[model samples]
Target: MIKWVAAFLGYFLFRFPGAVLGFIVGTFLDNFGGSGNKASSVFQDYTRQSVSPADFELNLLSLCSIIIKADGQVNQRELDYVRQYFLSTYGKEKANAIFRTFNEVIKKREVSAQRICAFMEQRTRYEVRLQLLHFLFGIAQSDGQVSKAEVEKLIEIAGYLRVGRNDFESIKAMFIEAADNAYKILEINKNATDDEVKKAYRTMAKKYHPDRVVTENEAIRKGAEEKFKEVQKAYETIQKERGIS
Candidate 1:
């Protein structure tokens, strides 16, 4: 429906907060307007939209392909991780449609991470781009250990996506464990003052809130929720270390 497209664009343009606005406005138009399938001015400009939603899926597949081949050996667990996540988040039919492209076109060639990241940076919101990085990390770590080449590839891809060093490190910490990784996840220093830790927790929580990307999709919400839980875990770890309740 045009309304779903509108809702998706709203989220795509403004992040998750705008999804409700788009859906409500869409319903209002559906009830009050005529029976034509024309798009409203509020829905789209058509000219400005160089990237379609389908483009997101394709570019995402490209990123996955790049990562899978990063270490020069394809691990079935990593491949299964990618496929299962897609199936759970996007459903069976749609996941199959995407995998068809992945197995057919994307895997057949050397996908340029630069080209895909360039396309994504032009069209995606920062939060969504962060999610993309997180997804790649998830794939890399799915097989028990992250190979050095895989981490290097992920860092390079993050650079092309324009993700800052801290943000990239934070996502990396979520998978690649370290002693002070919890601090890294919160984007705070290991010796940050208790008050500073509290402040950082609040900030990161808001940034990674489930509502930020949870609109209209349960599995997507779960993805955001997992990130949010990491922020909580970081805060708790710091709190316990400092004996602050």
Candidate 2:
């Protein structure tokens, strides 16, 4: 077991080459001893190395391209929204570099939304997938409205990502304004009692909580935090409407 762990540590050390990788290797070794069949499955799933940060960024920008062009035209407001996201996550220099690459890809229109989503579904965790969906919605609504074409494209991409209908609707409510949007955001019904609303809020909060994303990637965690805030805002909106504290 010592030799096995040492071998893994050595490989990870060479592959990842950072303190975070060290911590991950240590955790893997600690869990490997007690994990059983389930642990083996987990090791196989996570240890294969999920998408790298660069690849994730590229995939995100590629998908964003699809979203912005959903209405057959790319709006500056939509591009700005994506640029702001990259700016906050990667800072000025890297964000500009990414934007340049994104523009190049956008001009070529070569990145297939279905293919990118498939890669994400196979490589990313559910929390990450949810975050991606949320980001896409933000892009869709950047022009102050989510057109039917945009929503249709988003639905198709969500399907490719294997995101559940409930989860997709939950995120969709955050952006697309409607009379019963608050209820949809909370994944509840208009006729639901205050107590039921509260329970639903708690359930959605737990599911979309940023802390649920266990990754060293700060950008991914930040994206999850945005979704968490959206869930909280939805709950608050319902509370305001129902006069529930």
Candidate 3:
């Protein structure tokens, strides 16, 4: 872990300058694309992140919001990702505000990556930062799809968080890759028969089983509740698709 942390810090420092430049360019393009429109609102929100004072977790939340908005539209997959995270990490009031502010900000016209990074540098604790990076990767993987752009952006955020390459990859596998086949919740595939579907559900339920996770990490157990629900949902979807009651 110490080695991973050290590698993470080095990577971030190395990539810091380029990321700042890219953020500036991205913000400018967002503004130029829509001088005065709803899209412009997103740009405005993106740029103003500079002035807002936030703690590490909040800063991470803001950054995730930006990345989620990057592909042009926010869908249920991303929403489920964010909602699961906030519900797990914070109380209802704080979670509500975090979600609300995230929605409100991304609607603006411009953003300053330099300012955002400065906030992260000053405010984020190393562990919390790493966790947030992991969460963004989870969001990116929700649809079982990763674009070149999204992967690059996630790497950028990992660099900013000073997360080591190995640790970041672990995060990718744990959160992103694990959650990738979520659309499977819509139907069981040809390779999977009725018995296979039941078997998959049993496996997932055991894996995300809240009781098991709670025994391991009381802090994250409640958060696992939402994930466990997804497992159950998938099982139900498979049953419905197969007409197996």
Best-fitting candidate, measured by TM-score?
2
**Cα lDDT tens digits for candidate 2, 81-112:** 88887788778998889888898878975668
Candidate maximizing lDDT? 2
Q: How accurate locally is residue 241 in candidate 1, as Cα lDDT from 0 to 100?
A: 83
What TM-score would every model get versus the actual structure?
0.77, 0.78, 0.46
How far out, in Å, is residue 110 in model 3? 3.3
lDDT of 1 by residue, 109-153 (tens): 577899989887875557667777887888898999889999999
Better of 1 and 2 by lDDT: 2
Tens-digit per-residue lDDT, 98-165, candidate 3: 77877766676555544666666544334434445645666777766766677787777677667767
In angstroms, give how far residue 29 of model 2 lies from its true place.
10
Q: Where does candidate 2 stray beyond 4 Å?
A: 1-49, 216-219
At residue 145, candidate 2 shows an lDDT of: 95
Instruction: Give the whole-model CA lDDT for all candidates, comma-separated.
Output: 0.78, 0.79, 0.56
Quote the lDDT for 61 in model 2: 81
